[model samples]
Target: MTLTKSTFTGLVLEYDSGIVPPPYSHVFRLALDWSKGDMIADLVLHYTEREDLSEEEILDEGFTLNDDYNYQGPLNSVWIKPLQQLYEKTRWTNKDIEEGGITVTPLEKGKDEGVKIPSDQEEWQLMAQDLIQAIYETVKKEAPLKVNYRSVQGDEIIDCSLTVHFSNREVIFEIAGKSRQINWEYAIQLMKIVFTPDYHYELAKEEAGKKRGAYIDCGDGFWHELGKGVVNIDPSFDAVSKIRKGFDELISE
Candidate 1:
């Protein structure tokens, strides 16, 4: 759907509702002029759900409810505006898959492109919006999930919001609820490309000394590079390494 001025605000509101309390649902509201008279704001929400609910139930709530609120930030508007522009100029196709349902054409890289953006405005917006929707769905699906997180120093978790525009980079992440921690596989996915191997090595060493060392620390570029090719561990690399000699070879090779 083409996001008009009114619709734009509604999108933000809907997304925001999924994170913070009502009347302050949105964590970030991003507005962009794009040299035009009108403005567009991309809103983002962060939520954490429990194992007791269904995805449908989560959607109905429209927000994640956890005992702790660690994932808090001013949603960066600068990132959203450019993403909107990039989406406007791109082309993306969706097709029904043999497996079932529909699949989005994976984003591709262009040669010397002008800031590789999302394929289509509507489709991209759908992802940002659907991230909340997906979480709601996952909550319903009863997937085994947990999170471990760190946040600003405070006695209580505080809700936050951010509005950005024309920024160079955008980042999105969340904190796991208390007693909930990130699965090593999923955490690795998020951390792979964002951090360097050396950084990840250091993080691994640091986390190894902790009680929950079963979770891999994909800090730095580890989050971003996960999809490309990298090994991940649930408990610890050393434990996994004993199970497979290829682990050392893979890292060095």
Candidate 2:
């Protein structure tokens, strides 16, 4: 069957009576507004059983609940099942609605170009810290060395120190006061940051040739290179060679 706003309204109404106690039965009203492509469902429970109650008393006794879901593709194909599940599983809480109580499908097919969800800074910081730690541990496994790395937390750049034990294959991170197993893959990924300028230049050149922007994930995070002014510059061979030599010396020790 074709899914429309009315279909959603009917589904919500079907589950409204289940939301409250029996005494509050038949007092729930469900409203759906779809004027803007986005669907909003508003559920209000009124004190309808007590006809003798004054309008003010009724207003005081009623409560409202709201949920929003985005719509873009065919409703029947994309949202009907999740909508039904959301209605069935919704519950009232002392605070705001519990997370995961509502599930909305993303508009993959209809998403507008150039529209992007902003990244969570805190989450990105945490990921960066983990990657740095993992890389430190991996290098420490190869040799006895003292490595210094920096991670960004909020507006602060925190410096970290690591002591690598080649015999036991353990890396002790002083900042976190913890030790983790070596992760070689993560170490290689972090090494890319040391050569980022080189890769960025190459990427910019490639994008200039293609006349489009290039998206790159050099194991750390996503980076974009737009084709605007592409300058042919040599990758930082000296810096990369120095880093390799230093690592080799550490392993020899």
Candidate 3:
């Protein structure tokens, strides 16, 4: 028999988390299929976070698989070995394949049009390294300084200070006299969204005839906005541009 690789995207694997109180449910992605029987299947898993859930709610609700797509197949017993191999090769802990339901459907016709899955831990590390390097280069021009900005917190204008230290891979932000250290990867992503040409233009236009600050929610638990007379060497802008460039290069590779 000829071994072939059948790649599936958007496959949801649902299982029981073995938790009481609400009987927590868990979901994972089976992105690839590599089997040695009739067909070999390799699994690529995706990670997700429920933004609508609070910490306690998430713990109670358990894990949830994406229900956007569905899969249908006659799961053969011969495929069990391959699935077990996959479990050992990756981060998946449980071996209860029978308990976890797997669905396979045609989500993408070509590789180019495939779904944009979440980055794996390895990929995240590489991206983090690139972001740290880029931020380091950008911050070198002005070391040990703080930039001020205005942000809206519950309908109030608040002052925020961004401090970049050359020795660390984190950006320090002081809001309401409380300091938080945001990692380079997260800060880069936030800046990319806020500093985009369209978003920046819109912010400028909206603030042209208004007193309210133009703010964008970073979605990482912080709101960033431009302050009056902020300097030309804004770290956010520099880091965002570098991140965009790095991402483009990564994709091309």
Candidate 4:
């Protein structure tokens, strides 16, 4: 939309990069002086009156305003691919999991086609740790982390919500309106089993147990832990058993 110099004053244009969810909008301000034949463009990200992402991150990853005087929009395209990758990598949400396990996908897939992992295992772990910490904080300060994990039951597929309430050194699973608590240490271990990159879950055709038809299993560590138990694992057998039951009952309606 073109306007006279005076009309363009105080004009702000919003671009929906489709990077973040709703209630978050990133906008661009155009200081156009058509009469004087001068214009300046600046990109700004905000949610309501505040910005959830740091200014530094946005500037570093998001596209800057065009210096070309004739430049025009098409702004709402998927332009913030870098930022999208960052969000998908460093965050764990309901979208990251399916059938009670993490989805297998590339973490980086950065600008450089040859680049993949952001360095080494330590860096990957650090990013994972940050996501885990954010989950803990949300559970502690905000609300319980609620995830709707999908279940495959023979010919039926259903999604069920699992709520994790973290407090002190333990976490509780509220399932079927009943709550079961386990040590934070054990919770972390289970998360690793579900979120590890080595696993590629495929629903088994044959039923293994009452809920096995719904909860698919494929990861090696998952089976090893169930078979003879890991050599170094000295888990509370009763608590582990209870955790299994809770997960199985997740799809129970």
TM-score of each candidate structure, all chains considered together: 0.25, 0.19, 0.27, 0.26
Candidate no. 3 TM-score: 0.27
> Which 10 residues in a row give candidate 4 its minimum summed lDDT?
107-116
User: In candidate 4, what are the lDDT values of residues 1-253, reduced to their tens digit?
Assistant: 2222223222222222234432333332221111223222233333332246456544565423321112222221111232234424543333421111112122121111121222233433333333333333433434544433334456665434444443223456554456666554455555544443222233223333334232323322122222222221345344334434555654342
lDDT of 3 by residue, 1-253 (tens): 2111243321222222223222233343333222223322222223333455566665455543441222323233333343333323433222333433333222322232322222233432333233223333443522543444443435566555555443344567676778877565555454544444332333333232224644433222333344422222555565444533433332233
Top lDDT hit: 3
Scored by CA lDDT, what does every candidate get?
0.30, 0.34, 0.37, 0.34
Model 2 per-residue lDDT tens digits across residues 50-126: 45545565456553221112222212122233334443444323332222112122222233122112123233223
Question: Of the pair 3 and 4, which is ahead by lDDT?
Answer: 3
Model 2 CA deviation exceeding 4 Å by range = 1-143, 152-155, 188-253
lDDT value for model 1: 0.30
Model 4, residue 187: C-alpha shift (Å): 1.8
